[model samples]
Target: MNQNYSKKCAPRRLMTVTALAAFLFAPASASLFAQAGAAASANSPAADSARSAARAADPLRGTPSTITSAGNEARTQQDAFERSHRLGLRFYNGGADATCEVALGRICYWNNNGDVPPPAERADARLEREALLEVLAKAQRENPKDDWVNGMRVRYAIEGGQAEVGLEAARACGGTDWWCAALQGLALHNLNRHVDASAAFGRALAAMPEAQRCAWDDLTLWLDPAMHANYKALGCSGRGAENARVFRLGQPLWMLPGNDLQNEWYSRFTMSRVHSLGRLPYDMQWGDDLLESQLRYGWPTAWSVQNGGAADPRPPQVVGHEPTPSYDFMAVPSGIGSPTQATAKDWEPTRKKARMRYSTRYAAGYGALPHQFARFLRGGDTTILAGGYRLMRDLEMGRAPYTAALTLDGFDGRAPLQVVRDSAPANSALLVPFSSTMLASVEVLAPVGKRAARVRNTVSPLPRETRLSDYLLLQRGDPSPTPTLERNATQAYGSTEIEGGTTIGIYWEMYRQASPSAPLQVSLRATRLGASFFQRLGSSIGLSKALTPVSIKYNDNGRPDGGAGRSLTLNFPSVPSGDYQLTLMVSGAGVTDSTTQVVRVNSGNK
Candidate 1:
């Protein structure tokens, strides 16, 4: 036997013998034995049948069938071993091995005794510690220089709050073992040697396999400011290193205005990089839930573009579905007169009609607008402009433009409409466009409702130069709109109504000739009505405090077409049941504009 191991075992052996005697003679031993007998009886056929019936009635029961045969005895023993092992590590449970029958009995007794060991049972806990020391000493004697045994000794010492001893044992392992390194880190951390602890933790993480890393590893690294700071300083060099760096740098920027914008930023910094790193699938990832919640519960209205005018905003269901691509442009169906129409040359008219047909087929085949955008980006269709005015129009109005343009070509719309659904999948080809022959047979189909009249009034016989600058105003209830473009725009509320704990949604579009990359400052302010008394008091006191407005500031990145839009909901700290004026002011590129609306806040009773 190793001299050092023998010295450790000598006191442990004496303690173990005394513990064994006490365990055998304790008054509670009789009760424990009786309980064991009862447990054995409980595993009988009748008891098993009752258990099986209970499991059958349990809605949340696992898929596995209940075991009632002799196999159940083995399972019971296995469960007892697992339970005893866990309890032994946390609280002393007599000196029984994890798999020992006595350990199992002690576990059952402790559980039956309400998880609290009585004063008399405290002796058993001491015995369990002695047994553990004896077992560890024997293992050390078998292999005194084994790094794993030494690491385990360090863990045991740390668990017993002997941080200094744990550190000494950990040093003996030479930091090769991950557990020893981890224990050393913990000891150093407790001693306020943060820099040393961080180094030790980094070494431990380096030694651990990626698959073996658990929540505890993340918790330890994140919860320790010193460790996290060290990791940020030195740890980003592997496959996902760039992603980690970007996330840390960009999380602060996720406070942008809209959920869509915030999600775009978040996806760009985190999800996209994660996908690029092959850690997660691109389409399967989702954005921050809080942002999504804000969009859904804070603003519930739709904003739809109207020809030659501000968008006719409506509730979500009334607007149906409209796809908003990454560009700003307007499209009017054929036969409609537009304010910015260009005179069509002989060849230009035929080509314009053909482009409309192509966009229709593209939309039907792609199932999504972004897929079409991707194709445009790839230079797949060189005939189409990089900006692809034709594709943009088709996307903005769905099939409305193409069907309307084709109707004027002296062909029935039935044949071309049939082929809309017949086009191959967007992913089937590298580049797919509607064949010229197919376009020749197509005719334009007019859109329904006021949209038809608007289209007819706006469509030019020739290509037109249209400026994209336009303003839009929209409002909804307290809850926000959903994040998706198709679902976001809700119908504008006719009468503003406010109640207890309700917020007011304000949305607007500001058109400006400014750099798209520049930040536009927008402010939302609310002024309570009935300021006459304050105005009079201010006049008398020579202090102009009347009509003080509560406001919040937001920074917006100007849009692609020198435009900026915002949908924000506001709540006042203390709003009595009365009337108020809500105003939104936007400023950028040496210009500013403000719009105000009156709202009636009702008391809780009505």
Candidate 2:
């Protein structure tokens, strides 16, 4: 128990702080899904009245079940109300037309709740027709160059099989243009056109502005958890990317030199490219917790569209997940046993040491410290954690006689300290520092007995040439297991054979060692032609499916490893009877490399 430092806050101050916290770092709720089955309860007048009131307050939104018990009841209710309104605005007001907005809003609301309006009343259905048209018309009349508007128009055309119209619109709208370019890309894609679509999408990426990008970045970081989740649930990966393009419009943006964009940015960096970081459909506890904390306490103003919004305005959110070079020394203890070491795993120790990969990153800091620190982390001598989070406490360098206790909050509903390590007279193990202002640390129980393992620094200080894998992973979610086909490593990119209609599956991991958080993007395509050709063709054809787009965002508090790890799945329908090839890309923050596998398909299966 610590002393209360601040004066007692007024209800409004408390509300604002609580709201801010919810906005910055609220966790996603499993109960959100359960609400779907819990409709307005028309059978009860009181329940019906509550539902009607909710609808009036926010035409399309649902209440998140994950409420903080620590806060006052009024505060909690107020936070919930504000969050619901924000969701309504994000889904219903932020898009092309009322219908699309509402439909998306419905999806968002339903994501946490089971009840959804019928098809006729579905906002998505209406948006698919009228609202999209309105947006297109508005773009054409007022801001034809606006990429977002044009992009939607183009997409509607492609989906409606109006390939010619789509191409014209795309041609008229440059990639640097906002939604317009997205629309053109989508339209071109529908007509079995890949090259044009790729170019369109490329232009969109290239034309993006740094300032707009900055704003969008803010939105992703600060937007409410419920709102963010609803946005992702709308199958809006490409849309979000396209939106990001809108933000980055008019900026001399450059993607990794290779044909891949999704993989390059999202995967290499392990930052979520599609979904908002710390949003839903992601179940990891730490990520959720950290996100909640960020929402409540981090620099959310930075994430606001109006302000220099980023997830936080505070100094770079410290990564507590893993170890880095900033600290004098960091230690990570892992019990590596063979696949089936049976019960005698840790004890049946052979001399074989488990080779662990630590992901590392440096926050953009001014002066000599941050940059020098980055250099230090990359110097190949600094040891980092698996997903680049915590800096291990260096028992070797730090003064001894210090103890650290790990405390987990949610499970027991009490702040119980877990593991405590004490250093000898002159030295102590590594101490993990909390760095991210956007995320908070939930003290975890430190393991006992096992000597704190030394983190081996392996980053090479190589010249910064265009590393394809690195760039790709930076663009998308965390990469797959293996990167390029290095002769030394046993795992190499593989090949698969498929019939025309046969489905192919893709897999990968999203790891962030620091805050139990990592955002990711997953995409799969086949290059019957060369990579470039397929990319272009895919873009032109508007064949990219949002459902198939793989992107997982990291969270703050549950798992130290940013528990964004998962096996992504991609399925392809029957293609034309020709020799076809496939490419799958995954990316995220704190991820170093991406893995690719090629597969061939024949027409007989179709």
Pick the TM-score winner.
1
Best by lDDT: 1
Error of 1 at 287 (Å): 29
Q: Lowest lDDT 10-mer window, candidate 1? A: 1-10
The CA lDDT of each predicted structure is 0.31, 0.28
The residue-by-residue lDDT of candidate 1 on 1-606, one tens digit each, is 000000000011111222322221111111212233554664578977986676455321212343222223322433343234323322122222211112111111101111112112133444543444445444444544444345444444543446676566556653235555665665565444545765766666677656543322221111123334534544334324333322222111111111222122221222121112111101111223212211211110111111111342221110001111111111222211111231121112112111111111011121111111111111121211110011223333333333212111112222221222122121111112221211111112223211110011111111122111111122333243222111212222212544545554444444444444777777777666776785647645757423433568878665544323335556544445666676767787677766665655666522
In candidate 1, stretches whose alpha carbon ends up further than 4 angstroms from where it belongs are 1-127, 130-138, 141-148, 174-179, 205-536, 539-606
Global lDDT of model 1: 0.31
TM-score of each: 0.23, 0.21
